[model samples]
Target: GTLLTSLTEELPINLKQLDNVEKTKTALTPVFTQFQQVLEQVIAEGKFTALPLTITVEGIENYLEYRKIDFALGKQTFFSDWLPKAFIQNTAQFETVTNLSSSEVAQRIENLGSGEIKLLSVRVDSRNIVMRYSR
Candidate 1:
């Protein structure tokens, strides 16, 4: 069986036109209830020892700003402490090679023998050229 499992829950809130916190909370209450129910069922089942959960609330920045929720203690801390610590496990996989020319980058890619090579990022000065290679 695969180790990773993805679950996406779409909340009924327009990210572009966000309302007050109370309204947002009210809108999310049902989805949160569903999540709670699923979690409770999982707990009752006794299927796994440790379950790593990652919740990605899209457009949360706008909502946070709209709600005037100040993260006095940095974003990373807020995410790890407040949200879920499991997120910390999701480390960046791409490798960044700085100060490389376009031809150098091409050469590097060509050298990486017969695998899927993804060009994550590329800049003019080649300051932060990120690449990910997988076999």
Candidate 2:
């Protein structure tokens, strides 16, 4: 949270780069290429289809990077509108949002209490998820 707040304020932050990125790239390149090929084929079919692929990465959460991937399904789907609209509606419920003051947020961070705790300000606009903390 502190790192996020610092970023909002344009303050310098200390971050450690993940080592051996080249190694990871070299290992995953072939798999990624194959995956791309599969997606291209599926897209070319132009059918109401769902493709499932599972990916796992190590030590990414601790890397202090914020990443969001959003794609519109309407452009790719054979049917018009309904699937994409439903998809957008379903995901809006999962955004972590909070209205607490920054001091209360700081206390939550300080305590690091057990079990599930979410303190954030999230906005979902046009099906795109934007997350901000103390900005």
Candidate 3:
């Protein structure tokens, strides 16, 4: 079944938006990890169907100006500005994305850490991206 969904979550990453404010890896997780770690706040929105899940991050304490993700269908029109060049070069699956089983992700996460997850819970429903963490 084909579902249609369009939602705008433009609220800042403040206490009001995130009820249980804690260590969250928003859509900007990779951006934060690969680029700037000083940003404590940002904004995020995904078109649900867009293959690459467009993520936009604006001024967080005026660190950087406008940045946008251009993805239409099953391909990213352009690599994220801050996306490490090594990432693009080292990307094993460039032509397509491989879906990893939950157990696979869990096992890999466990291997990377001492049985802890970055995003404890991640799911999509009613055209929304929901997440939770172990607090």
Candidate 4:
């Protein structure tokens, strides 16, 4: 496996947005493992030389500032219940803007929570670039 200098990808939503917060949070066993697998896969195969790869968020927190809500990549050997809390805490003021389709917005929300939201299309991100999911 080669040492990866950089990797780009979307950050998953928080786990608190689930309808049944406790149950959903408790049921995150598989998701955490999947996340770990993704990381391992990258480490095992990727060899990015870019100092900082650009990762665009496709959800409410498109600017990547909301990542703080997510568990630190290297922390939490068992990341079973941080996703929802992170989402609720971060994208609290999500508003749809131009350049993003309604379907895209809906997809993002869908990725975040198990419920539904009207409009379903709120894309934010103008000239300023926001790097998301950095370790």
- Compose the digit string of candidate 4's lDDT tens values, residues 8-121: 443343545567766665566566767677677654433222122111232444434443323222132221112222244223322212233334333443344322222223
| Per-model TM-score on C-alpha atoms | 0.29, 0.23, 0.18, 0.21
Best candidate, TM-score-wise?
1
> Per-residue lDDT of 26-82 in model 3, one digit per residue for the tens?
744555554332222111222222232212111112211111111221233222111
Clash count for candidate 2 is 0
Candidate 3 residue-wise lDDT at 36: 37
Best by lDDT: 1
Q: lDDT score, residue 63, model 1?
A: 30
> How badly does each model clash, as a count of residue pairs?
0, 0, 0, 9
Off by over 4 Å in 3: 1-50, 54-117, 125-128
* Candidate 3 least-lDDT 10 residues: 62-71
Whole-model lDDT, model 1 = 0.36
The segments of candidate 1 whose C-alpha lies over 4 angstroms from its true place after superposition are 1-10, 50-135
RMSD of each: 20.6, 22.0, 21.8, 20.6
What are the per-residue Cα lDDT tens digits for candidate 2 across 1-135? Answer: 111111112212222322566655655566677666666664564322422111111122321221221122112222222221111321321222223333333344334332322224343232233322221
Regions of model 2 farther than 4 Å from truth:
1-18, 48-135
Task: Point out the worst 10-residue segment of candidate 1 by lDDT.
Answer: 72-81
Report lDDT (CA) for all predictions.
Answer: 0.36, 0.29, 0.27, 0.34
